[model samples]
Target: MRIKYAIPIVFFVALVIIEKENNIISRVSDKLALKQTPQAPIHTSRSGNALPKRNVSVTSLGKPSSAFTLMKRHLEKYSEHQQAAAAVTNGRKDILLLATTRTGSSFVGEFFNQQGDNMFYLYEPLWHVEKMLTLETGGTNATATAKAYCDVLRQLFLCDFSLLERFIEPLPVDHITASLFRRESSSSLCREVVCSPFVKGVYERYRCRNMRCGPLNLTMASESCLLKEHRAIKVVRVRQLETLRPLAEDPRLDVKFIQLVRDPRAVLSSRMVAFPGKYKTWSNWFMNSDVLIDDNEVKKLKSNCDNIRMSVELGLRQPVWLHDRYMLVRYEDVARLPMKKASEIYKFTGIPFTPQVNDWILKSTQASKETRGIYSTQKNSAEQVEKWRFSLPFKAVQLVQKVCGSTLKLFGYKFVTSEEMLRDKSISLIEDFL
Candidate 1:
């Protein structure tokens, strides 16, 4: 009986040992399976929200997650903010008074030109570029001409006159030229400091005439530009705003654009009077009552209208590059309320409205009699805004409306269906545009 009991105990001990060994093997198998299986990647959701925490390590060479990309973009935007702040802190502000011809750019440009000694203004610096290109190649290569215009403008804004000298008529001799386009319009250019060794004290119109002042020394102009706190340029030759992207994006400069627009009908009327020689064909068409939409001159007008409309629309869309950097002002609005509009413009340009600007606006807009010079800025602006109605024939008005219908609508210019409506000054053609 004792031997049998001992045998059963031995069997029981064997069974217990075998069971323990099997349990250990199952645990080892489970660990091996866990090691071989691939784990899901640790990442944020597509919306950039973080995922629940897990015990996982990401490799250095792994793909960037959505959160990483978002953080990178944020860093880049912050860098842009820092750069813009640095620009503002440097006391350098560049203003581009952009407009088309016959859009009251000259008159409006005076807002900056008369801003005392702190402002350096350039009037139509692109004129030289356009004139030279037209003479050299009849401006057939539109791309080349556009590039040349932008290059010259970029240099001018940076106070470098070397590029501009190449285009000046009788090419600037030793950086001196008598024919800086519209030199009289820039107070900075006319000052005793820039004219040099000629006029004394403040610039007197008669005393500092090109004959008396001799040729403009571009070196002196550049020096004056560096001394000024701000630089402003008024240009009408820039047909497309997108062409200036390089200048606008330059990190070395802080640029702003104020685009001035006018009614297409008024612009056409003013162009006819200001450029009678060029518009003689249009005048003949008017006299003969034979205006055709397909005529080259009419086509040119349509192109101009389209260009202006496209630029204005682009600006209004507030592209990332143009954010807080573009403004649009109508000529009629500026004309009817010169002081208020000038204040608004000055505010937009980040400049102080001075007594000089105020006095000039008062004198310019309140003229007793209309100044008849083709390029004159002095006028009774209130009267001049609608003088086109008298000068432009009803037929011409109808033609402009048909060709520039979209532009007119976009710019808040009302169309006249009858000659009586064209002649009625009491009826306001300008609708309020926010």
Candidate 2:
């Protein structure tokens, strides 16, 4: 069969497997003993229910898991050689593209991945850690959690996943996918790790739960971690800006931040449309309440808008030490002029706008009219940005606009009146004039 036709079929099959796997996991989680404790009223969508504990095992690899040991040795040897070469030139950079949900961060992260051999892009390694933290602590302990978060980030930059084992055991599929399968700098070390029994065991466990495993035979280059020029992590999990302060000030690493923001109205509108009746999982990310009092779509949108504003304000109020290391980018600007925006972002991170990066931008953003899911890697950037305007109800838009008025002004996104929403065909979320 042709590649185009086969792609959709494979995606459909994978989607089915993932959905089944989620159901199985939920069932298993419920069946497991809930680890009774003081039963303090913790936060969850299910009202008054405590966070259920799971069987979390922190693998104490005596000899190290075969894959882990091999990867570590390879990275160590490679780093020795790389450090010598890099000493003659500029060292590698560590960049973080930080954003809240529905802000086109996944799209932006792909820019680094497009660098192929030169960049090591980690797609939300901290997501699993966040999950573990919330489960264990009910999302308390801000300071300690922040320290641990930064610590894991530090280790990952140094190409170490063993430090992450305590937080996440048996390695989540997404982690394996990013580190091994889809990575650009997959060396012989990477291949050995991917094909090891450890990864296969995790894949088999996922398969038993009806989840699909990533490809086992994907080819990777020899430049695993030893020779990468840049490492960028795209994260949407951290709510407090203070959590990243330590990372920003680390004397050993050159870290830069790109804070991506979107108009709250557009963000909420997109969320409501894209995930109707299914946002309880991430609704309270920066919000106080879980389920909105009025279980309606408009109320959810309003709540989401409030959360966005709060999150943006928190990110903007960073300490003085982080001032020079940070740059803010708007989703609207990036969607409209992908290459230009990408170039500006590259310049901020000290990465050159290579021809390959530009080519990936064009292909990823301007692909043909195929139905893409919300979690799709490729995006029709311009359409995706402007979609909320026509898709959202006029009244809903008015509510989001009202809640986010100050923030909109802060980001230079003009107010969209109900009348304009009703009659204007060429309404833009962002103001053309500064």
Candidate 3:
């Protein structure tokens, strides 16, 4: 009996040693294979320009490798498989309503936001990144800030809120936070399933009065996102369209981009009213009748115009990836013919023109008077289009025309040669074509 027990014990010890040796060998082989693998070649556009590479660093957030990091890596590796699977499932459509501030983005965003129950719409999800990680706020440079914005957007698109939670003020506890920017703008977040124990129909009023709905449960938000057939995010923070090429190329997403542009002069005019604090200098210049062509504000305006023109030019080039996936819609066109333009936009996005959306368009575009709030979407859109001509000084208009000449021409906005031409509603400023 003793001899039998001794033989079994020795066999067990020997087996353990063998297993340990095999584990070590396997790890070594993996390392060798990894070392031998060549780096992926640089991706290039159809025009043979090298694409910008994202420097993905898990340590950038000062946390250990988390679910978001792992998911990003997994997606990168298995994107082809995921794309095939998505195709089989009839794929979730992702639309980016890309625009600049004070350019009627909020009103246009409602086109997707009010698209009934099947759509998950996020308004300015990048607001947190822009708010938190700016040079003045977080001591980070433009490149870092841009990376953070891109990372946050990518995670949001994947319905993974882990990365975004990091940027929220007063960090989330148990993935629950009330700090989500523009939470009320997202109807899905206000749904019964996500924010429970609330008055069903009076979410806005209830939320405003009592704050009874409590903080948003990001876990629930993610679950809600997964159930939606499509997702749309309206963003004003992303400056360069090329910066988003990777997102458009993402295999798990059927991404479509609608570049919503407005007349830069109108944009400047609107910005002056909407962000009076920031544009105080411009207001002072206008008030004092002192317009400097080479001022900092004027240079910034030129930079903005140049950026928009460049982005528009890139879309027009129609690289293989963006071919048929990109569109340019002027705010003026959409404003002039809401229903017709909405129909065209909906058709372009492959979403149905539901009765709910039609009703919303009819009601929203026919406001007897503009709402008090600067951000309010309700407006007499056709009348609102040329309202800038009255508010913006002729001198300011000429200055904008000078700085944004290329952009204005590219978007088919006619330069107002005089105050009369600018104010005359009958003299159409929008050309039929470029």
TM-score list, all predictions: 0.77, 0.65, 0.79
Over 116-163, each residue of candidate 3 has an lDDT whose tens digit, in order, gives 889998989888766655522334344445556666677677666666
Residue lDDT tens for model 1, 153-241: 77677677766766677766556666787787777887877665553443332234434565577777876886788999999888899
- Stretches of candidate 2 above 4 Å error? 1-89, 138-144, 171-223, 279-320
lDDT sort, best first: 1, 3, 2
> Which candidate ranks first by lDDT, i.e. highest?
1
lDDT by residue (tens digit), candidate 2, 325-352: 7778888889889998899888878778
Instruction: Give candidate 2's error at residue 107 in angstroms.
Output: 0.7
TM-score of 3: 0.79
When sorted by TM-score, best at the front, the candidate numbers are 3, 1, 2
RMSD of 2: 17.3
- Give, for candidate 3, the lowest lDDT window spanning 10 residues: 32-41
Best by TM-score: 3
Higher-lDDT candidate of 1 and 2: 1
Q: Show where candidate 1 strays beyond 4 Å.
A: 1-86, 198-207, 290-294, 370-372
The per-residue C-alpha lDDT of model 2 at residue 146 equals 53
Model 2 pairs in collision: none
